[model samples]
Target: MEETWNEVLRDLSVPEDIATKWWSQIMVQYTESARIYHTMDNYLRKKFEIYDIMVKDNISERSAFVLAMFFQHYEHDTNVYGDSIDKNVEHVKNFFKDAGINHEGLISTVVGLLGAACESGSSKEGIDAYFQDLELAALGASPDEYVEYITDIEKEYSNMPAHFYRSLRLKVLQTLLLIPKIYSTDLFYEKYETQARENIEKEINEVLK
Candidate 1:
C-alpha cells in the first residue's frame, strides 16, 4: 500500500522526499491503536481497490479524485460524526500548500469531494456520485465480509456502552436503508444494489435484533 501510495504521489509529480514524509504522518493516524475498522489495511485499502477499478474504467479528474481518496480518512474521529470531513479538507490544503503545489483548482476539487462525502443522499452526479459509491462499497461485500465489517466497526466503538452503540448503529442502518439507492452510479447500482440492501436488512433484523 505504501508503494502504491508513493506511485500515486510520483504520478502527481510530488517530490519523493515530500511523499515519504507525508506518508509517515498519515500512517501514524491510520495505525493508531483505537483504529479497528478504519485501519489502513481494512477501510482505506478497500477504498483504494475501488479507486483502482474506477481508474481501469477511465474516470476523469484522476488527480483530484485519487488525492481525495488518500486524504478522505486521513483524520477519523470515532466519537464524532462528520468532523473528520472538514479536518481532512484543511489537511489537504495545508499539504498542497507545503508541497508547493499551487493548483488551486485541483485542491478545490479535492476539498469539495471530501466535504461531499458526508452527504447522505446519492443524488450527486458525476465524480461525486462515484466517490460516494466507492466510500460505501463495503456495504455490498459478501455476507461473511459484511459481518466482519460490522464486527470490526463494533470493536472500534467499544468505548461506548453496548446499548448506546447498538442504538446509534441501528439508526444509521435504518437511514441507509431508507435511501432510494445505496449506490448511485449505474455500475455500482446494478452490481451491488440487491446485495447491499440484503446485507443491511439482514444486519438490522438478525445482528441488531
Candidate 2:
C-alpha cells in the first residue's frame, strides 16, 4: 500500500520528504495508541478523492492540490472532533483558501468534519456518532471517548492473544463494510463507494485466504 501511495506521489511528482512527513505523522496520529480508527489505503484513496474532485471542480491543478493536502498541517485521520475537529476544519478551509477553491459552503459542511454533525439528527445517530465523531468529527469528539479507548487498549494489549488480535482486526474491517456506505456526501458515495467496497472486500478475502 505504501508502494501504491508512493507511486501516486511520484506520478504527481510529489517530493519524497513530503511523503515521508505525511507517512510518519499519519502513523503517529492514528496507529500509535488505541487505533481510534484507521486504514492507510482508505486515506490514500481520499487523496485520490481530493484530486479527482479538484479536477472536476477545476479548483486548482490536481497535482498542486495534492501537494498542499499532502503537507497540510492538520491531518486527515480518524480523530474525532474534540481531538482535532476544529483543526481539521481549519485545515480544509485553509486548503480551499490556498487552492482558490472559493466555495464558501464547503467549510460549513465538510464531509468527515462538520459533516458528522448531521448524524446527530439521524435515526442512526446512536451508532453513527461513535464512528463519525471518532473518525470524522475531528475536534468535535469527546475527550472521554478518546481516553476510554486508550485505557481499554492499554488494559487489553499486553494480554491480547494472537487469535484475539486476528479476530479483532477482522471484526473492525467487517464492521466498516457492514455500514451502508463509508462516505457521507452523495457525490462521494455515488462516485467512489462501489470501488471502495470492492477494495475492502478484496482485502478481507485475502486475509481469510
Candidate 3:
C-alpha cells in the first residue's frame, strides 16, 4: 500500500518529501491497536477497489475523489464518531495547505466529498452518489465475507456489552433496510443491491434472535 500511496502522490504532483512524510503519518495512524475493521488493509482497501472500477469508467474529478478517500478516514476515532468527522475535515484542510496545493476547485471538491461522507446519506445524482456507494460496497459482499465483516466490526466494539451492542446493531440494520436503495449508484445498485438486502435481513434476524 505504501508503494501505491507513493504512486498516487506522484501522479498528483506532490513533492517526494511531502509524500514520504504523509505516508509515514498514514502508517502510524492506520496501524493503531484500536483499529480493527477500519484498518487500511480492510475497509479503505475495499473502497479503493470500487474506486478503481469507477476510474475504469472514466469518473470525473479523479484526483479529488482519491484525495477525499484518503482524508475521510485520516483521523478516524471509533469512540467518538461525530468528533472524528470534524477532525478529519480539519486534517484534510491542513494537509492541502501544508502540501502547498493551491487548486481551490480540487480542494473544494475533496472537502465536499468528505463532508458528504460525514453525513452518511445517499445522493440521488452526481459523483457524490458514487462516493457514498463506494463507502458501503461492503454490504454486497458474499455471505462468508459479510460474516467476516460483522465479526471484525464486533471486535472493534468489544468493549460494549453484548446485549447493548446487539441492540445498536439491530437498529442500524433496520434503518438501512428502510432505505429505498442501499446503494445509490446504478452500478452498485445492479451489482450489490440484492445481496446487500439479503445480508441486512439475515443480520437483522440474527440480532432479533
Candidate 4:
C-alpha cells in the first residue's frame, strides 16, 4: 500500500529537537520535566478527541484543518485562546467534537496554538492576510505541482537515500510554509538557520544510505 501522510509522520517519531524546542518555549516556563509526560498525555487526549469526532462524522474537508492546527501550535506558543490557559484549554479540548481521525499530538498542539492565536487577536487577521498572499502565489496551478516539485528534487538528489533527502527537505518546506505566520520577522532567521544545520547533522546524516 502507498504511504499515507500519517504513516510517514509516525515512522519518523517525534524529533528530539522539536521536543526540546517545545519544552523550552512553553513547558519549562510553567512546569518541570516531570510534567512533560503529563503534558504530552493531555495533548494526545485532545488529539484523540478530534480524531474520534472526525472519524464518526466523516467530514471530507480537503484542507486538513487538524494538521493546520498542529502546525500553528508547534511553531507558535500561542493559539486562539481567551483569558487563562485553563479557560482556553477547555475550548480547545472540545473543538474536535465532530472532526475525524488525525495525528494526535500534531492536532492538539495546533488546536492549542489556534486558541492562543485567537486570544492574541492579531494572529487571525494576520494569518488571514498571509494566506491571501499565499493563495495568489499558488495561482491556478494543479495540486500535483507540489508532488512533482518534491519528486523532481528527490530524483536530482537520488545519490542520497530518499528518506534522508526528504526529511531535510520536509523541514525546509515546513519552515517556508510557516515563515509568514510563524516568523513574521527576520529576527528568527538565526534560529531557523541553526535548525537547518541541526537537521542536516542529525536526520539527514543518519538516514543517508
lDDT of each: 0.84, 0.45, 0.81, 0.37
State the lDDT at 188 in candidate 3. Answer: 82
Candidate closer to the true structure by TM-score (higher is better), 2 or 4 = 2
Q: Residue 49 error for model 3, in Å? A: 2.1
lDDT of 4 by residue, 183-209 (tens): 222222323334433333443344454
Clashing pairs in model 3, backbone N/Cα/C closer than 3 A: none
Estimate, for each residue in 78-145, the C-alpha lDDT of model 3 and write its tens digit.
66777878888888788788788888998888888888873556556577788888878898999999
For model 2, residues 1-209, the per-residue Cα lDDT tens digits are 35544664576455777666555665464444433233343333444444454233533333333333333324533323344545656655554464345544433334343434334433332222332322332211244443443344334343466566557656766976887766554444555566556655655675587
Error of 3 at 138 (Å): 0.5
Which of the two candidates, 3 or 4, achieves a greater TM-score against the reference? 3
Model 1: weakest 10-residue lDDT segment is 50-59
Worst 10 residues of 3 by lDDT: 118-127
- TM-score (all chains, Cα) for each model: 0.92, 0.33, 0.92, 0.23
Q: lDDT of model 1 at residue 13?
A: 87
> TM-score of predicted model 3?
0.92
